[model samples]
Target chain A: MTHSDPLTIAGKTFTSRLMLGTGKYHDFTVMRAALEASGTQIVTVAIRRVELKAPGHDGLLDALNLERYQLLPNTAGCRTAEEAVRVAKLARAATGVNWLKLEVIPDPKYLLPDPIGTLKAAEILVGEGFTVLPYIQPDAVLARALERVGCATVMPLASPIGSGRGLRTSELIRTVLDGAAVPVVVDAGLGVPSDAAQALELGADAALVNTAIAEARDPAAMAHAFALGVQAGRLSYLAGRMAERESASPSSPVAGVVRLPDPEIPA
Target chain B: MQVNGQPHPFTPGLTLHALLRELAIAPERVAIAVGDDFYPGGQAPDCELAEEDVVEIVRAIGGG
Candidate 1:
């Protein structure tokens, strides 16, 4: 927590450890406020093609202040590698940030990122000079595979996307963390501030949160709480925790017990 | 004509700019694509569209 340097990923440096998601808020005003309160440097935005609003009417981009936060465009709706790459290119063309969150989820029920498709898209994105951070299941093999293919970081999901279930895949996520050389960003399914704190305490490089804060009654306050949680967790990680054992240690010396007279004997 | 996965009336001489105007989209707000080809925000005016082309109007939305 005392660290003052930027977080480096794939040769790029960012000042914020908490990456905010600009989704599920009631409106842009609250979203922007929450973003400011969180003090996030990176904001993840999805690529969407919807029915156009009236001309001169601004969308989320207008609400976003790029000077305050860097926009990280994600291939959120893409179900294949081709789709993800296409979205990635479109995002770069639009926002001009080379950093992307490569998400290719063909399965909608669980919203799990497709392993093969993610790996494929990561290769293409890396070759295209994009800093790729792939959202994936907490599969150790897939995490390593993504790292080998030149992804800046591997973001393993805590639970299903938007489930707010919180770290359903703890063991596997730990498995991935154990062997990860690059940063392991715990992404998705984080429901509370403690979830993020726990992730950092487990030695994750960071956590990307959205639904928890955005869906809260007071998003701005929740955002601040999460920022505090991240700080606490990171500090705890740096501070280190005590080891565990099967039995308890002596609280007082056995030899230090004082002798006393029996009241019934009336000594 | 399909716009945003919905069928619309097809009209000849429909340039990308006119389509945006018809849909009331501020050209600067979104990035355009016809099938797999992406055009810069400014290119929408010159880029002509063909019938049956799946035009994608991509805007930034909230994500995590």
Candidate 2:
């Protein structure tokens, strides 16, 4: 409940374990309110070609108070390592923040991250002194590889992007957690707060959410709910869990049962 | 020169600031990349643009 135990990534500490994506909001007003409600210290934004006279592009720079939230620029639309690297450079130049969410999603249909591209980009970006957080499929080996390559974090998706599916690769995510030397932030395809909570409960350092909160009936309210869920999950994880058993265990002492006289017999 | 994948009229010895002025794009709202050379918002003023270069002007948008 307190901010004593902070989530540390790349030597930076964050009180809130929930990260938010600044996309799919109805407007900047709602986005601002949701972001404030979510209590997210880091917000993800995409860098794309600025369309002249575009409505949405002009406002985000002004909406987010940089003092309150740290902007994490993402290479969302890039398909290759080179493209992702270029976007990372452009994002760093534009945002003046070296923190990057390196995403190289080549397949547009499912919007899945390319493992090869992501690894290559992570290596290059980390080499350039950028704090790279590479998003990839829930592959344990790849997660370790990225960690070895100096990535700040390995963000493994729970499911396909924007699918609203919760923890389809939970087993794989567990494998990632098993050997992880760095923080693992579960990113993408979390449908509800429970999904985010589940990620934390499974030993994830954090969870990044977008569609679930942005598209909610009340984005701000849902954001608050997610924050609570994350906290609850973290607390529960710290509190630990009971062991499983095949048979039922009695809450009361079985040996303390009072013996009753038999009604039958010679009485 | 190509801007955002569209062919634009090449101005000889054009600086990035002058090109932004010509296109009516606010320099603070976008980051420019001339081929592999990158220029953050404020630093693009002195960067020169070449005729055959592909220029990508990008802005921060909502994304997860």
Candidate 3:
């Protein structure tokens, strides 16, 4: 099935609805192959301890050709709004890309985003002409507030980052999709292909998978599976689903149900 | 003081963390790769700097 309306974020059109992260792959070669197999147009990269000016490190950056996939640099390790803003600016300058994935996690254990810090940083980044895509909790009100701040997209976590718990916030996720004016990209904690499919089926504009695909027995194959799952989910959502009923009832009467024993008759 | 394989002036008596703070660098943003080992941000305070030591303080930048 062909995708009629490709997903677009921050004026960039992506044929693939799945946004894959570049970390946790066994090797760069495997990562390259997985990215190709996944057909991911955008890949996320964390900004943490890299000597960009060093000559030898150029090979790592060179391996990722900007033409094939757009580089989305994230402020992954930031703890506060000030730190996030600073990192976002530095990332924009270093990568020459305006797109940023704002991730401000105060808690190292869970890596859960600090909503207040994320919003504060996002507001500043958006005003600074950066295309901010905040990794936020599945809070409908927070999603709306982020949209109001001119965020390019709102990436709500399906669960804690790297926990692989799957969609623990399905209800809140649905609420976000129903209310969000901007794209809702389900990011993080997607353990497998089915998790990604579930997110897509729930009307998420895109799903970001990193550890699940990278840590698989075969990263490339897993990437392909995720790609298919995302596509299936998107198609399912587009096709729409029948409303579910609380109690089970036959849509058509059974042929043998015509005669019933009298109520007073003993079995 | 030695940083990234270059000798630089340092206060006669200052902790590695103090030197970093004097440079207006956030400890969290910098990772110290000393000798053949990598020390996390928190370890900087106790790890005193020695002359001609290969103190590689790598900062986080944008890249995959």
Candidate 4:
């Protein structure tokens, strides 16, 4: 279950099923090490203040060479559809990539996705020929609606963004996986390797993780661990599971075997 | 001189970059609009400030 297995989305074939986020890293060196260890082909990036021409303005883009990985720009801070659309356009113009991670969170405290705004933005962006990947709550109906709007993929959160609570909406997530036409990516709130494994076991097409790896004690090792966990989970899903039984029973009968002295029985 | 909708004491010879540092605004987050023209990040250093110079600095913020 190596990354040799192909994952196709929006006519693009990716070798890796794990999508990594480029945030909360101690530095670019560590980030690069973690990314290499994870073997992720698609990496998520947010458009923030990065001085383009300044001598030393913390150029994250320089570190993330575009040739190696496909950059998926995100509208992380946008709170409204209009704002998201504007930011998406700017990101496309700046980065030359039509791939967008549409995240419209209105509340600063919780950072929950604004469903109405997200829907509006997705409709517009899809019309504009953008590959939309909407990060949303684990709502089956919402996932279906997004698919209808021509979304490349539906990224349902395992929990709140960066909370690391792990798969809070397991039932709804399963519903999405069962009903979704496109790929179902378990995005955010994945605390450890076990969480990623559990999501893949529940039939998630992929998992997008950031804080769990970047904030780990050793980011590179954690990234490798996650890579293996994702592969194992997908393999387990492919290998069918057995149904659970309520009570245990012996295959041999216990009560009707008392007639062992019947030597006259026919062979 | 004013920048980003805030008042500032006028200096005879002040640059946009210096003014940005004074206001604690990162140059990357802001775009300067002055005299019906918009200047991107690179133009900030050479642009000098004058009396009654109406400069608008737009900063990136969370909005969808």
RMSD in Å for all candidates: 2.7, 1.8, 9.0, 5.9
Q: What does candidate 2's lDDT look like per residue over B1-64, in tens digits?
A: 8988899888788987787777677778578888888888677857777889898888888998
- Model 1 error, position B32 (Å): 0.8
* Candidate with best TM-score: 2
Q: Compose the digit string of candidate 3's lDDT tens values, residues A133-252.
A: 999999999999999999999999999898889999999999999967999999999999999999999999999989888888999999999999999999999999889999998879
List candidate 4 stretches off by more than 4 Å. A2-4, A50-56, A249-267, B1-64
Q: If ranked by DockQ, best first, what sequence of candidates would result?
A: 2, 1, 4, 3
TM-score of chain A of each: 0.92, 0.94, 0.91, 0.90
What lDDT score goes with residue A147 in model 2? 92
* Candidate 1 lDDT for residue A107: 94
i-RMS, every candidate?
2.2, 2.0, 9.5, 7.2
**Candidate 1 residue pairs that clash:** A22-B62
* TM-score preference between candidates 1 and 4, better one: 1
At residue A77, give the lDDT of candidate 2.
Answer: 89
Instruction: State the lDDT of candidate 1 residue by residue for A127-202, as single tens digits.
Output: 9999999999989999888888899899999999888898788888889999798988899999988999998888
lDDT of 1 by residue, B1-64 (tens): 6777777677887888888878877667678777777766666655677888887777777777
Total clashing pairs in model 4: 7
> Of the candidates numbered 1 and 3, which has the greater TM-score value?
1
> Which parts of model 3 are misplaced by more than 4 Å?
A51-55, A249-253, A256-267, B1-64
Write out the backbone clash pairs for model 3: A49-B60
Interface DockQ per candidate: 0.60, 0.69, 0.11, 0.13
